[model samples]
Target: MHEMSITQGIIDICEQHAGGRRVLSLDVEIGELSSVVPDAVEFCFEACSRGTLLEGARLNILRIPGRGHCLDCGTDTPLTAAFGSCSRCGGYRVTIETGEEMRVREIEVDE
Candidate 1:
């Protein structure tokens, strides 16, 4: 899955940003459309973080909702998944508003 690569990237960032500190916990924000599988990422972290500063680091994932905007109704409405459907009006040209991001929101390190 893509999360494996993503997790590797996160570990790299942590290693670079941790600056020789031991990682205690990592909080990541994953959107619905991020295409990341939490279980797979967690499983891979155990192997990817071996011998690294984040060997025993805890990974916390926060899931974000996918939102879309209705073009016909001119309203920023929230829809399910990637389907761009308007709620107020019968339109299929709704634009996405959120749930397309993957970022490291916070990190805890030991002093």
Candidate 2:
């Protein structure tokens, strides 16, 4: 899964920033639309963190719900896994707001 690779990348970045310090925790924001499975990512975290500064680190995943704005009706609606479609006005043209992000929101480490 790509989440494994992504987890590895996060560990790499954390290791670079930690500078030999022990990683206490990692706060990650996973968007619903990002297609990342929280359980799968968490499962891979331990493997990815092996021998790194983030080894045995606590991984905190914050789920960010998908949000969208209807362009035709200007209605803000919660997005489902389905394609772009306005829930209020039934408009087909919808602008996605947030919920497509996957990023390391914060990282905690021990000095």
RMSD of each: 1.4, 1.2
Model 2, span 29-97: residue lDDT tens: 998888888898899997878888898999999988889988888899888753767889888787778
List per-prediction Cα lDDT, in the order shown: 0.85, 0.86
Residue 68, candidate 2: C-alpha displacement in angstroms: 0.8
**Which candidate number maximizes lDDT?**
2
Model 1 lDDT per residue over 38-94, tens place:
788889999999999999999998888888878777887766667757777868888
Q: What are the models' TM-scores?
A: 0.89, 0.93
